[model samples]
Target: MEKVIILTGASRGIGRAAALMLAKENIVVMASRDINALIELKKEIGASGGKSEALPCDVAKENEVKKMIEDTIQKFGRIDVLINNAGFGIFKRADKFSLEEVENLFRVNLFGVFLCVKYTAPYMIEKKNGQIINISSVAGLNGFKGGSAYSATKFALNGYSESLREDLKEFGIAVSLVCPGGVNTGFGGAVADGKISRDFLLEPEDVARTIKYLVDESETANAKMIELKPRRRKEFR
Candidate 1:
């Protein structure tokens, strides 16, 4: 049977690419705030003879997140995989940073991950098998000067993923985190402080492949955490 995958942030970038890649052989429920874009992606997947459903969801909202999970379960009967990829980041200095914006950022980046896992894990625990792949950033591993909010959220996500991995192990559920460095995704706009020298930029598809590998790995060899960075050069963005 084809696995049913719920992918958030499926409107663009890594999430979009991962949805397209997984839909080839899996039943994908694509969720994101961009309903229009999700529809377009679903159409493209249909053209390729892949199966998918476009479910508009704002991961930050608890009610909406609950509904998204319910809607997926109603349609697919079970969810075998969940890719938490919705996130937003902006460059801001500490002195000038907007606390309101930081709170909003954490809502989607950090809390979003928690909400998804909380709702999805119970079903996995019941089934005794599932895979959760969280898309984090290199910022989680190394802090940059201007990325106060984004870095903090990702750092929190990393810690959460580590603990979740251990907790799910006994239930036969695998949890993995994919941390990629400076992808070509245009969301990563400006770079200040330049602490993490972006000498090489990874492609969104590269991270997608890593996710697929983790999903396809043997059950015994649970791939816990994966970090991807392009081979270093002199300089990049």
Candidate 2:
């Protein structure tokens, strides 16, 4: 049987690319906030003879997340892999950004990951087999100017992923934290307040391949972290 995969933030960008690519090889249940985009994605994959389903979800909301997981379990029976890729970036200096906005950043990028992992882990543990891939950014591994809020959330994700990897390894669950540099996607459009480096950038498809690589690894090969950077040097944004 094909692996059962759950992915968040699947409406666009890296999440969307990952969902499409993975569906070619596995059964993918994609969650995202945009119902219309989800429909498009579902149709595209279904037309291609791939197995996929899209559900409307907002990872920042705990109740929504809970419902999504419950519904996923009801549909798929169990989750074999989870891709925590839902996130938002609010770029602004600490002085300019509101506390609410900063908190929103953390809610989606960090806390959202926590919520998804919390909901999905039990099923994986029960099966004694699974993989969790958290799509962190280079910002998680390194700091960037004007991105204090985004960086802070990603930094938290890095630490969370590290700790969880140790805790889950004993249960046959593999956790891989992906730290991608610049991926050409809606993320650039979302950066209304923060400026991203304009030099060479990684494509969302490339990052999706990284995610696929990690998820497809043999149960014996547990990759903890993988970082993707531009082939050319660019000043930090």
Off-target runs (Cα >4 Å) in candidate 2 are: 188-194
Reference-based TM-score, model 2:
0.95
lDDT of 1: 0.86
193 Cα displacement, candidate 1 (Å)? 14
Model 2, total clashes: 0
Write model 1 residue lDDT over 174-229, tens digit each, in one string: 88888887776656535323544444667779888898887677767777788787
lDDT of 1 at 186: 52
* Local error of candidate 1 at residue 123 (angstroms): 0.7
TM-score of each: 0.93, 0.95
Residue pair clashes in candidate 2: none
Q: Which ten residues in a row have the lowest lDDT in candidate 1?
A: 189-198
Which one wins on lDDT? Answer: 2
Report the C-alpha lDDT of model 2 over 138-177, residue by residue, as the tens digit. Answer: 8887786677889899999999999999999989999999
Predicted model with the maximum TM-score: 2
